[model samples]
Target: MNEDITRQLREAAEAHRPDRAQMLARVERGMAGPAVRHRARPFARSGTRVALAGLAAAGVLATGGLAVAAIVAAPSPSPSATVTTPATPSPAVSSPRPTSPRPTPVAPAPATTLGSSRPTPPTTSPSPSAGESQNGPLWSAGSLDSRSTIYWTQSNLALKTTQPLTSLTIEIRIVQTGAVKNTGTWQTLPSDDFTVTVQEADGALVYRWVLKPGRTVPAAGFEFAAQFNNGTAVRSAAGDGYRVDAQGSGGSASVRGGFVPTR
Candidate 1:
């Protein structure tokens, strides 16, 4: 019952605007005789609600000269006017003195970003977990590093092939989430065994690793990782992807896929 009354009161208060015309009408209605109020006991709750709302509204409306209206509506005797004269104000005291207003509050700074200490809830939709996707002969998997700070992040890519490759090129594209820039890259394979180039094109940091002449990707697993700056907030890698084009004794085979999204 208390909750019901509170809900009704809020609804009534919101419906009642603190305005002049309604104030006078309410005042006249509220001035009913005691006998009339006694006969209206059935509507007691509603009456009390309006009366309380009207009192609160009066307090707010009084700031807009409702007090003067009250004086005019119910005039007092001439002696009451004389009584107010003695409460006179001096020019210096009442000439719109410079009152010091409360200083406007400043909002606190935004969240200072850093790597998540624990597993943090992602901001984007849940995606396939890392080590989920397999593309062609090149069994590929990807995951964002746990040490990724807000301003910079790293995505690790793992590649595996069942067949030894005579020629291979690995292309990893880091989707342009925000302020993305490649800091550096590394791989499990010998650095001299591959020609690596990192460049920005088509709104992404494109990292390409070509098996150097005569140097081949083995049948075993290999790791090719790249690190880049993501920006000041957790990022999503929905569009980020990779492609592997390789030629073995069997024939040329290719596979392409995107990195799972992350926050």
Candidate 2:
């Protein structure tokens, strides 16, 4: 049995033995086939490259769409910046305003006349009847009736001076039968019992004394005489010393009196 098995293996080896030339030819064909396949591989790889390029193009388009969408969705600037731009011009338009015109100047009316409206009547001179005698130790001029009773007198005397004096001293003598029986002294004429109007007439002060009900006057058979005491003389408007005119019984009798300066 061992001999039979050895013989079969020897036969199979001899039958399967390759020819050297044929073996070489077969290896050469196999090498040429790989060279042809290697030459055609570039065409297959070109299709794969086209598919990768399409995928890359799709990725790029998606990225660009995302960028555009982000730009459209973003918010604008704040409202404060828009408000501040218009506020800058508001103060500029309100700065200049129109000025109003000043009122026209007016002149005052001319000065009107002073004091009472009624015109002052001219002073009348007194006329004395005959048989009337007026005498005094200090008498300068004038005559009084010795027999005429019921006499009334009025006098408006004015005194002009360079200096201002507060008051005057006047001496009144009561004469009866050509003798001074009683004497009275007064600081101001007309006293407080009479209505005396004192005013400036023609730039000189004039005192108006009316012998009304309450004034002093002599009774029947007596005469009233008056003169300035010492240091009472003043200048007159006629550029002379002080002078006075007295009218009695409603201009029925009158007397002119003069003042003699003491110093």
Candidate 3:
């Protein structure tokens, strides 16, 4: 009977335990009351794997960019590298020679009425001739008046009979009709072809001619003059009238003429 009573007391204590919901509420209260704190767990190993993979990708990109930049920065070589070249500075590009300025053309001189270097025969005066003067030959056709005149005469003396007369008188008589422009004189050559003197009338020398070598005697009115070589000149009438000693070969055929001033 005592053992049955102990068993019944233990049954009564078990039947009186708190309901399950109420027990759960008490456990929640204890948890929320700040009696404990929860901790986060360490990251998964797979996440560490992902992070390592991303680092590897960034390293690859950086390495590729560096390699490309190095290649681009490299220098290139010139084509003539192998040749030993002269150091001569590139020939200064000589500025193309400035073209010589074209020369200005000159105008030709005009035609003139003035006489040529060659001598010309004196024009005869219109006045009547005075008979041969006491000085020499008789005046037959030309006048010794102020107007310039040229008088010529043939010698009757034979070349043998006549001593060579190279000298002759050249008179210039300024008559009432004579003009002052007639101021010069000349003695004729023995050849009867030319007349020359230092002055036409005390003028600068002018060689006057009636004939030239290798040329024909001019027409009756034609006349011209040229200078002979210095020694070639025969003595002239420059003194005491123009005079010359004639060469002996030709005699009577030797002719004489005088150039006289009229002014």
Which pairs in model 2 have colliding backbones? none
TM-score of the candidate numbered 1?
0.48
Query: For residues 68-143, what per-residue lDDT tens digits would candidate 2 score against the true structure?
Result: 4444445655577444444444444565667878878787532111211222211221233211224221122223
Candidate 3 has its poorest 10 consecutive residues by lDDT at 152-161
Instruction: Give the per-residue lDDT of model 1 (tens digit) for 216-236.
Output: 777997777677767677777
Report the Cα lDDT for residue 240, model 2.
Answer: 15
Off by over 4 Å in 1: 1-136, 261-263
For every model shown, what is its TM-score relative to the native structure?
A: 0.48, 0.27, 0.24
Supply candidate 2's per-residue lDDT for 12.
45
Best by lDDT: 1
Q: What residue pairs are clashing in model 1?
A: none
Give the residue spans of candidate 3 off by over 4 A: 1-42, 45-47, 58-174, 178-182, 189-263
Q: Rate the local accuracy (lDDT) of all candidates.
A: 0.68, 0.33, 0.32
Q: Write the per-residue lDDT of candidate 3 for residues 37-60, one digit (tens) a residue.
A: 444245655664566576555455
lDDT of 2 at 178: 22
RMSD of each: 37.3, 27.7, 26.8
Q: How does model 3 fare in lDDT?
A: 0.32
